[model samples]
Target: MGQKRSTFLFSALCFGMAFLYIPMLLLIIYSFNYSKIVPVWGGWSLRWYKVLFESEEVWSALTLSLKIAVMNATFATLLGTLAGLALVRFGRFKGRTLFSGMITAPLVMPEVITGLSLLLLFITMAELIGWPGERGITTITIAHITFSMAYVAVIIQSRLAGMAQDLEEAAMDLGSKPIRVLVDITLPLLAPGMVAGWLLAFTLSLDDLVIASFVTGPGANTLPILIYSRIRLGLRPDINALATIIIVVVTIGVIIAGYLMLRQQKQRERDMQMAAQEVVKLDA
Candidate 1:
């Protein structure tokens, strides 16, 4: 009975995987199809892709989206790293808990509410200070950073909490000041966490749609906004092609990252073994 149940569970998991992937697979297959509606399997052609490239509007949107993603990720990572350091390493003060909560509030708040609130804030600021007179690329970047920073802060705070302070202490003992110790020890140790936070921020900024839609003005639509507009019009084969390209790019990146990580781990292990051998030879 247990074996039968296990087999049933395995089959169920396989079915679940298929259910999740089949739509994506069909979309990819139909991207090459010459038919308007998908899954009809007309003769394959690269016409849709050609049309996608020929459209200057799509390229403009894509370029703008990439620019936003890069800028937002850089700003968000810097802000989040500082916030995470203060939250995890700085002295606890009055409203420490409140500050932490406020920093992370964007994460839990619905996108609509967040966007609306940011829009209102921007309007008020513009009215008072005559800055950011209208919603556009700047507003979208601000909105994305608001949420992306929260995510980065959370990841970095966790990493900081797990990190040992011994290295910094040792550096201090060797005549380094606090800032110097941080630069030499803490930042080096936090390199992986920083990379992770930056990547997370970049992904969130790139994928944002709902908030971007609300905050974006007439002429500053990102790729996601453009894709959504197209989706509302109709499910085009070009979208499927775009999605497939994204999937392939992401897959390749992950594979390369994994390979590099494994290589680094092996290198570290080899160094440790060589050090141990040296110590053993000295003892003999």
Candidate 2:
């Protein structure tokens, strides 16, 4: 029975992995096909890559997406961190429930609804304040920030919840002002969570399509939007090449992050061992 169960689990794992990765592998392989038609396999060549690199539209869209993602991530992280701190650190203030609900509402909201609401808000703002006369990078970035911050806030909240308050209380007891303790103790401990939140926010912003589509105006296409439009026209080799490039970039990022995390874990283990040794020596 145990052997059969193990075999079934192993087979399930393999099947799941293949289900998720086989499509990506095929896409990467097809990206090298020389033919313009995606379905037809021509001899392996870098023709599409060359074409992709030459396309000014692709480059412009990529540049704009990166800029928006960066701006959204930074602003989202800042705002989310503040909201998380308030929710967790500020003791039972009036309207705390309403505030927390508003911060997290985006998480459960439908993309279409969120996009429509943001579009309406932008139009209303334009009519009232006469700012953001046209919806483009600024409007898209704002839209991304609105939803991305919810994910960041959730991450920050979970991190803060798991963290012990002993260090912060001790800092405050040792003649440290509230601001000083927060800056010295709380923020330092929250650094990893903040970095994670920022990365998540960046990825969310970059991957956004619906919200960006609703908020963006003429000549302001994001990479996802461009790819989608191209796909609609028909699958092109250049789209495959673009996707392959994105896969490579994302793989490299994942590998680097894994290496850093493993190194940090090893360093933490070594510190714990050294502390144990010192304690034993003191006892002896």
Best by TM-score: 2
Which segments of model 2 are wrong by more than 4 Å?
Answer: 281-284
- Estimate, for each residue in 86-114, the C-alpha lDDT of model 1 and write its tens digit: 89888797899999999999989999999
How many Å off is the CA of 135 in candidate 1? 1.8
TM-score of 1: 0.93
TM-score of each: 0.93, 0.97
- Candidate 1 ranges beyond 4 A from true positions: 273-284
CA RMSD per model (angstroms) = 1.8, 1.2
Per-residue alpha-carbon lDDT of model 2 for 63-152, expressed as tens digits?
999999999999999999999999998889999999999999999999999999999999999999987899999999999999999999
